[model samples]
Target: MHVGILYSRIRRDEKLLLNELRDRGHEVEKIDVRKQQFGLDRMTTDVSELDLVIDRCLATSRSLYATEFLDSYGVTVINNPRTADICADKAKNSLALAEAGVPTPNTKVAFTTDAALEAIEEFGYPCVLKPVVGSWGRLMAKIDSRNAAEAILEHKATLGHYEHKVFYVQEFVDKPGRDIRVLATDGEPVAAMTRSSEHWLTNAAKGGKTAAFELDETALDLVETASDAVGDGLLGIDLMEVGGAGSGEYTVHEVNHTVEFKALNDSTDVDVPARVVDWLETKAAESDAAEAPIA
Candidate 1:
């Protein structure tokens, strides 16, 4: 099978997957989304040569057209474009999780700056401020003070991208020690690790340290629940324990569709790439089964 990994540049995790596919005798192509000028015509022309596409590109509104084009052309993406679209929006993820009966953090989204301030006050300080659409913990802050909240809003506004766009703020959960990163494949927990930080934020991008953690039943359930809610082939569930929301309860902080697996591989006994390939094979087989003709 010819596989095209649609990423900007090949990272370590992508390299690992590439090696795995090569070992399995699959033809792999690297298509850097950033380097290519993509549109309906360009993508349809370029991607026609590949049998499948593992979408690893960090899509912005600008690059979304290409991703959508690939989607429309029925390219076999690891986690369908629609799944990425749903996970991209914090508010939408929360609402969908709620509707699916999956528990998420107490989240409040406000459009105006004043309404954002009001939400901060109401939700109380020490809340987590996140861009409605982002990844890798970018533009995420733990607002412990009213002034800090104002500053974050001002900073976001200064960008001039969305002067009046809403931001997502969630009640901060007090888990001073560490947070859990669970990668679920096909609605089952595959690998997990605990990320510890000297600072309050336990994001790996923010100088956090990762260590192996056994997936307890609760962690597995949380990961599985999030995967089911996403209804995708793969999902990365960020879970944390919080106080003050309710006694002895956990809330999901975020869900990532295109997850970084190298960190988890370092901290667990699981073969992250092998598992991903296995999951993809299962999905591919299912698709073939669905398309088989009646005898």
Candidate 2:
């Protein structure tokens, strides 16, 4: 089987998927997404022959056309096209979670700097300001005052990018020291971890430490529910404890399409890569069955 992995070199975890595919006797090609800058000639060569594509391509509006180009050719993509995963936008993620009855932090989106300021005032101080399209807690600011909110909004406006067209504001969950990441594949919760740090960001990249956690029924249900909400083959759901010492709730924070599973493998007994390989093979089998000739 010929498999294509479309991702950037900076994606350290995507290597796990590639290695697994190779181990399974698939001819895996790692297509560096940065090469598209010169042109997509690298990605455009005979993709029709490939059995599967794990699209880790971070789609900007410019790259969306390329994704559509590939999807039109019937290449099996793990999370569908960039447009299908566009709900990865934090604002949209919140809305989808709400609709799915998956508890998420109180979140709102505002267009225009004035509207953003007004939303901050409405949501009140100690809320969070985040870009709609963000990951690993990057560019996520905790605003404790009206002035700080206004300052961030003004700075964003000065940048003159479409990112400023809307701002995501959510009620701060006040997670003291820990957050949970649930890794799910095909509606099954595969691994779970609790990351602890002194800082607000508990991502492993920020020097946070990880430990294994039980995938209890609630956690499992949350993982399955969030993955379903995102409509992806595999997903990583970030859950944070909201409220204070006495009363709190576990709320969904983010749904990641392309996830890092090193910590996940270390934290659990699950074979992360093997599970992904199995999912890919099942997809391939289903495809073959669908294309079989009828008597």
Candidate 3:
């Protein structure tokens, strides 16, 4: 099967997938998203021969638009555009998880600084203020006091982008020292890891240490529910431990599309890329069977 990897830059995560695909003898096409022009009806680069296009675009905007255009051309893209659309925005992510009856942190959204400040006040101090669209722990603040909340709100209000104006506030979970990141395919857990950090943001990209984690039945349930809520695809589901230590309860925070797995691969015994390819194979075969004429 021929697979197209959509990326602006091939990071370590992309490199792992590429190597695994090549080792498996699958034809791999490296499509540089920065250099590609995706038209409403067509893309400048031909994808007609490809069996599947895996979206690895680092930028959310690129991932969202690229998959949408590819879908329009009858090309199969993993983590479909609608899933991308919902996962790319924090507001949407929060809503999906909550609506699905998943135990997510209490969240509130406001469009203006005044309304945002009100939310912060209502939630009280030590809540979190996050950008509506971002990842890797960027532009997130743990507001500790009313003054701090006011200052952060002022700063966000002055920012020119509309995304900044849309404040996403959530009650801070008093997790221990780590959070779990589960790499799942259509809600099936491939591997799980714990990211530990001294900072409130425990993202691996934020310099957290990673180790393998075993998921419990409750976690498995949340993973499946959250995946369905955001629609299905390859995903990284984040959960923070709640209640007392070893409480065996979790609150899912986000579902990531175009999830990175090099950290997970290094920390766990699981063959991350190989399992991803296995899922890809299944998807490709499913696509083929669907497109085959009824006879």
Which stretch of 10 consecutive residues in model 3 shows the poorest summed lDDT? 239-248
Top TM-score prediction, candidate number: 3
Q: Write candidate 1's Cα lDDT for 82-168 as tens digits.
A: 677767678878887877777688888888778888989999978988888776677778998999989888887777777236778
- Alpha-carbon lDDT of model 1: 0.76
lDDT of 3 at 29: 96
TM-score of each: 0.90, 0.89, 0.99
Candidate that scores best on lDDT:
3
lDDT by residue (104-214, candidate 3, tens digit) is: 999999998889999999999799999989999999999999999999999988888989999999998999889999999999999999999988889999999999999
The whole-model lDDT of each prediction reads 0.76, 0.75, 0.94
| Residue 27 Cα positional deviation in candidate 3, in Å, after optimal superposition | 0.8
- As for TM-score, the candidate ahead, 2 or 3, is 3
Between candidates 1 and 3, the lDDT winner: 3
